[model samples]
Target chain A: MIIALTVLLTVTGFFFFFATTIGLIRFPDFYSRMHAAGKGDTLSSLLMLLGLAIYSLHHFSFGNFLVSLKIIFIMVFIFLASPTATHAIIDAGFESGVKPWTKEEERAEE
Target chain B: MHFIYMFLIMFGFWIVLSGKFDAFHITLGVISCLIVSFLSLDLFFHETKKKGRIAEVVRFLSYIPWLVKEIVLATIHVAFIALRPNVKDNIDPKVIMFKTRLKKDLSKVTFANSITLTPGTITIKVSDDEFYVHALTKKTAEGLPGEMEERVGKVFKEFGE
Candidate 1:
């Protein structure tokens, strides 16, 4: 049961990572690409970590339990850190005078 | 009181991360946590006209699940748009500038972080009460500010424009 669940979550995480890769290549602008990277990166890793944490507890030992808790701790830290990092990147883009892509500019550029 | 609470929390995290219970390691954990708590007292708690302390913290935590759900939904939305062959038609990138109702810096930062957490919307700049957001689609941008502002405001207990 645990194996099945872990495989499912790992696959889902990879699928999101795949989508992020596609978005990075296909998206028209830097901001849109950041969207893909930020959300995909955070959620995929979160799911993968959650699945790993749950699977780690399948044997039901004290050491395994502590390991699971540490995985969760990492998840929580990532939850807070990932978005802040995204905002910092966006702020950097703004500070450097990068205008966000508009419909007309999309056509005008190339 | 707050200092001790912060230290305890930090030390707990240290235990989880370090995975060691020996006397020397434990002493190092205590010393480091104490130093951190002292150095960054203001980082732990936001001092406002504190109200319904326990209730407010509970409410804010409750909002977290809803935010996670939103993040998942938005990720799926972005994923579809990214995966579809006609990606150009799918995305309408634009910057939205608006003022939020959140009063405190903590609330403002939280709101901005939440925006970035959700896919397709990245908060670019914040000044005073104003937020500049870069959104991947017009649909995502249209109905965002009002609902999110109200929700974050509830957490901070400031409920107006």
Candidate 2:
């Protein structure tokens, strides 16, 4: 059960990660790509971590549970931190005057 | 006191990991914990704050689970939106203003970070009476100073002032 679930999660995580990478490369603008990087990528990674946590419980002991809890704890920390980092990047971009793409900007010479 | 506290905490953690109460492992745990904590004293030596102490550590631990749930929910929401067929048509970006009641900087930053972690919100700038948030959806924008502010305010004891 653990092995199957781990494989499932690994596959789904890779799918989302590939989507994120593709979205970054193919999106029309920075803001759109930022949306991709900031939103789904974090969740993709967490899903992968969750599967790992469940697999870790196969050991079926207090110590394994603690290790699982520690992973969850780190997930919580990353949950708090990643978006803040994304916001910081956006804030920096805006401060440096990166404007959002208007329809006109989208059409000009593309 | 420091040595004892360190020994107790780390040894407890070691026992949790080793699943053993045997004397040999217990002694090893104590020694390891003491060494790490003693070295970590170098970190504490430069600190000057009095308000932040053991109580804050306890508070933060209590705060973790709720934050994780919020992150998961936010992540799901963002993923759904991103995968939608007509996502950009739904985008309604704007800046908003709201008041926060939290007194401490750390708690204030936590609140802001939570907003940022959510699907469509980013805290662009913050001041005492106003927080300027850049939101990607009108609905999200409308909920500024939403329940989150209240919850975070409660954590910082910023209620009803």
Best-performing candidate as measured by lDDT: 1
lDDT of 1 by residue, B30-125 (tens): 999989989998975766546578887898998999899988987898789989998888778888898876788878988998888775688999
**What is residue A11's positional error in candidate 1, in angstroms?**
0.9
In candidate 1 the C-alpha lDDT for residue B150 amounts to 80
In each prediction, how many residue pairs overlap at the backbone (N, C-alpha, C within less than 3 A)?
0, 0
Mind sharing the TM-score for model 2?
0.68
A37-99, model 2: which lDDT tens digit per residue?
886678788888988988999979877888898789777777667777887887787678877
Give each model a TM-score: 0.90, 0.68
lDDT of 1: 0.86
Q: Report the number of backbone clashes for model 1.
A: 0
Question: Would you list the clashing residue pairs of candidate 1?
Answer: none
